[model samples]
Target: MKNDEGEESRVLLENYRVLLKKALDYLWERIKVERREVKKGKRVITKVKVTLSKKEEVYKSLRDELEEVNVLASHYVDKAISDAYSVLRSWRRRAEKGKASLRKPKLKRVYVRVKSTLRKVEGESVRITVRPYEYITFSWSHTWFSPRVKGLELGEPVIKEDKVHLPFRHRLPWFTPLDYLAIDSNLYTLDAYDGEKFVTFSLRELYSLKFGMELKRGRIKSFASKHGRKGGKLMEKYSHRERNRVRDYVHKFVNKLLEMYPVTTFAIKKLNKQEMFQDADDKLSKRISRTVWRSIHRVLKYKAPLYGSLVKEVNPHLTSKSCPRCGRVSRKAGLSGVRGVGSPWTGN
Candidate 1:
């Protein structure tokens, strides 16, 4: 009886996720495109219109079909009656009126992303597609490709099948006692403080590959200076490699911290970010799991529940500031120039 109930609940949650995902994709897709444009020149609100058939079955995979439309948007834009600026204005007006349709409405587009299995129809324009459902697909095709494409390949967009299960964890109750500690992550080190002990490790150990790439890039740049290679391409390749090193640095740090300092509560610095661009949609985005702190949190969530560690976020606002002596505020904590500098022994 419980197994059946669990299955039903999972299905319901997945369906709910699918519905919300569609609505989010509508607004989010445009934002991603605009961000790329902002990186190129300026930031602008680009709205694209979409039209959805009122008939449900008529659009077997409605959301998937919309994605298809997004991929082929460049093709549409090329053939659009309005230019990029003009179409954006038109889209804004209609969106303000809350009349954006999902049934192939004209949308002013300024940016686009390369999703999974995306293939560009090479001719006068480039096109891409996403196979969302088993038999359904979403696509994008365009001529005005944004230059701010960092790490992306035009292929089929990866569609994550939603799954909501009890977060797998390994933690003991408060009643159970153990002698272990783990520090959280910060800008300096991966895990700075958990609650009891400070976890410290070298960042260089995990990202040896990155260090090697950096050395290779330096050689390439040197070669370029001697008219043998292009430094720009070499730098680009090296930067990505180094960034991957940082990601692995965090992951290894988190795992080691957890193992060394076993505790029920893992305290970490809560980062304040307006928007985090995670690479979950594209093939490369999959590697984003390593860069973001989300990876550590995920591990703690799953592994801690079975053990005794529990992940917790510290109030990053007053961490470096707020003198513990008189409760004054300082950015450098009186190290540089500020008032009410508390001592290191003040329960920091």
Candidate 2:
């Protein structure tokens, strides 16, 4: 009896996801078609206001179709419209910046964004709205998440692969530290200096792994060009593995750093990657792209707060060339030999 109930609940939840995704795709398709039409007609519409007037039209159109899927909620249809508009605006901005090559936005996967209000906790099971009068309730094991979810505002949930993932936020107490740890993030490793001690973490292994994967992918692509479909599948499999491996390593490295230091405040240099690499060689640019610097920064920013730590970014001007003792700037001062310099440790 329990197994049958579980199977039925899973089917209902999947149906709900499909309905939501359909609505989102429908709204997105309409918006993309209209945008292309406007561009082709040489209409000069302010990018910011592009979606504002079309929001109601898109919502109404999606609402009419969603009503046919009786189990799909009305509020979710509105949510889908809002989500599609957000994506469209992002694409428009990208196009203006010359970064977008495609004229139309496409939905390549099945996913839906569920508003937090539509999810209600009821004792052992959570009730998620499918429609105005219909709901699908499923038992959830919040053993580890119970404490974290308490007294926090939940953001929009993402439903994918038969699972609902919720994001929570809460006000945390501000952290203050008597001393600061300055971190110099380099291409190969992270060098950190706290008032009294200096430490470095080797990132060479990670770089090696990335380069190895890149070489493998290159060979795979070359093989795929000759062998066709099966080779293409193998290429995708390896690509996903590479990403997962890099992401996993970065997370583990950052977690260990936070655990080891337990510092109240951390500082890092602000790097303008685009301007720095604009005139660089393609090989150098590819190397930099393979390095997951942005991901490292993002993980540190969010994970530091959980440990009552704060992260700060300072201008990196003259960090490597400036002398610590005499307060002099030299073009020949290399970062390799210069150590125990107290100037970089000084307040900004």
Candidate 3:
């Protein structure tokens, strides 16, 4: 049922996956060896000066090792090594931030990064080189996004098993902001103060959806104990459904807020989740989980660049109790009947 070109594409994808995985495994092994050496050195001194091997040296070694064993083009090996380094760098960063696991990182997804040297683009089509002379051409001439990306610049492409993802970047000029929209996120509401008036976006529906899903999952746990496989699938389905629905709601809510105050700098509270949950009770933790304040902040941060706006995370200390009019922290201050003193955005 499949054509020759489709079959060839499938085979190429598989081969690229295998080759990329092999290179990543070798790089991870080398990283573990380096980590072991560092640990051994630290055991000898109270404050050991540790220095790992340079990235360029590791990259050169990886490229040389991969080239000697694989028959792929040199650029493929280069891109794979680059991706491996990216992974390694990300792991090191997360480890420093106490966000990564103690175990070494593993290759979770198989994909090839196609650099500019491995791809040629013109008009609506891109020709990607798979090997020395072989190529795969992709075109979006008939699709809706074709017209949208007419003048945008194309960056590196990623080749996955089922599809190739093309990244298009648009360069926009920066502008001076006219005003600030200060937003305070709570369990059931998002309050916005736009330097003049206040607006409240009720998050009752979002909270209700999450709370209902949590109850459903709780009830299914009993069924899961009896019927393992089928109940596990049900649990996964509901979990994914909850995640997707929450994501959709957050995106839409953030988009609406951004649209309301376009080109303005938005301010939000910088919340520390770990500190918040340190002494929180079961009910409080569930309420905090349903609020999903971080998702709102993250979506706003990333999407603000596109809207010519900026996002600033202000300190949460005494924010709700601070008077916006006189710039005074009061024990009984609220959001109503506050006149202008100075912009809260300036102090933050």
Give the number of the best model, judged by lDDT.
3
Where in model 3 is the C-alpha error above 4 Å?
1-78, 92-101, 131-134, 142-155, 169-171, 174-178, 193-199, 269-272, 312-347
Number of backbone collisions per candidate: 54, 0, 0
Residue 312 accuracy (lDDT) in model 3: 87
Q: 98-120, model 1: which lDDT tens digit per residue?
A: 46543223322222223323334
Per-residue alpha-carbon lDDT of model 2 for 95-156, expressed as tens digits? Answer: 65457754565655545566777878665456677656666555444456766567675555
lDDT for each residue of candidate 3 in 247-336, tens digit (9 for 90 to 100): 999999889888888898988888877666655787777677667889989999989878889998988878877756566765553445
For TM-score, candidate 1 versus 2, the one ahead is 2
Q: Point out where model 2 deviates above 4 Å.
A: 1-85, 101-112, 129-134, 141-156, 160-163, 167-179, 195-198, 269-274, 312-347
**Worst-scoring 10-residue span by lDDT in model 3:** 339-348
Rank candidates by lDDT, best first: 3, 2, 1
Better of 1 and 3 by TM-score: 3
Two-way TM-score contest, 2 vs 3, winner: 3
**What range of 10 consecutive residues in model 1 has the weakest lDDT sum?**
338-347
